[model samples]
Target: AQSVAQPEDQVNVAEGNPLTVKCTYSVSGNPYLFWYVQYPNRGLQFLLKYITGDNLVKGSYGFEAEFNKSQTSFHLKKPSALVSDSALYFCAVRDSRRSNDYKLSFGAGTTVTVRA
Candidate 1:
């Protein structure tokens, strides 16, 4: 089984400041991790993913995350925060070894408030 956790319910950041949303995951086998963002009243959009190789993975909207094997973490980060970046974020995970299972378990969403 795979599971994900987003410990913080909300993250407040000032515009132009760095922004981060924490996520942790666990799986019996190799884990596939993903980050998604949702604007108000909008469906979730894929931001990034970690399938293999490279500890640091970059994604759309100038965001990135580092995969930490020891820590079992994949935290989303942006060098600068924008008011427009305010949104709900989610972390998801799947067990890669379960080829027959495509189910993804998700963490409780984190709301990011980037203030101007």
Candidate 2:
């Protein structure tokens, strides 16, 4: 079974400051990682993903994530955070071992608060 974990339940950051949301994963085979953001009463918006390319992947709204195989981590980062960036973040993973398993297992989620 594959699983994802967001270490912090809530991340507080100041506007214009760098923002980070940590994530770790466990999978039997190669991992396909992804990051998503959800605003109030809205569905999850795709932020970024890590498949079989570069370790560093860039996504929407100035967000990026680094996939570290050694550490089994995919941490999301934004150089400068905006108040509008405050939302719930989720880390997800899909195991490649199971070709038929396209389903993604997601973390509990982390709430990010950006204060101006």
Candidate 3:
């Protein structure tokens, strides 16, 4: 089994500033980590994923995450913030080894507010 945690309920950042949403995970074996964003009243969208290879993975909209195996953390980050970036973000994880069942366990979610 695998689980993910988003420590912050919300994150506030000024436009043009860097923003980071913390995430930590736990699993039995190697883990596959992912980041998703949800706009109000819509479905969740994929951001980036860490399957293997590089520890640093880049995704859409200049967003990136670092896969820290030592700390069991996969934190999302953006070099600069935009007011349009305001939305709900979720961190998810699945075990490297899969069964017949395919499912993803997601974090509680973190609301990001970017102000002008």
Top candidate when judged by lDDT against the true structure = 2
lDDT (Cα) of model 3 = 0.96
List candidate 1 segments past 4 Å from native: none
Estimated TM-score for each candidate:
0.98, 0.98, 0.97
What pairs collide in candidate 1?
Answer: none
Q: Which stretches of candidate 2 lie over 4 Å from their true place?
A: none
How high a TM-score does candidate 3 get?
A: 0.97
What TM-score, to 2 decimals, does candidate 1 have? 0.98
Tens digits of lDDT, candidate 2, 31-70: 9999999999999999989999899999999999999999
Candidate 2, position 3, lDDT: 99
Compared with the true structure, all predictions reach lDDT values of 0.95, 0.96, 0.96
lDDT per residue for candidate 3 within 1-116, as digits (tens), equals 68999999999999999999999999998998999999999999999999999999999999999999999999999999999999999999998777666688999999999999
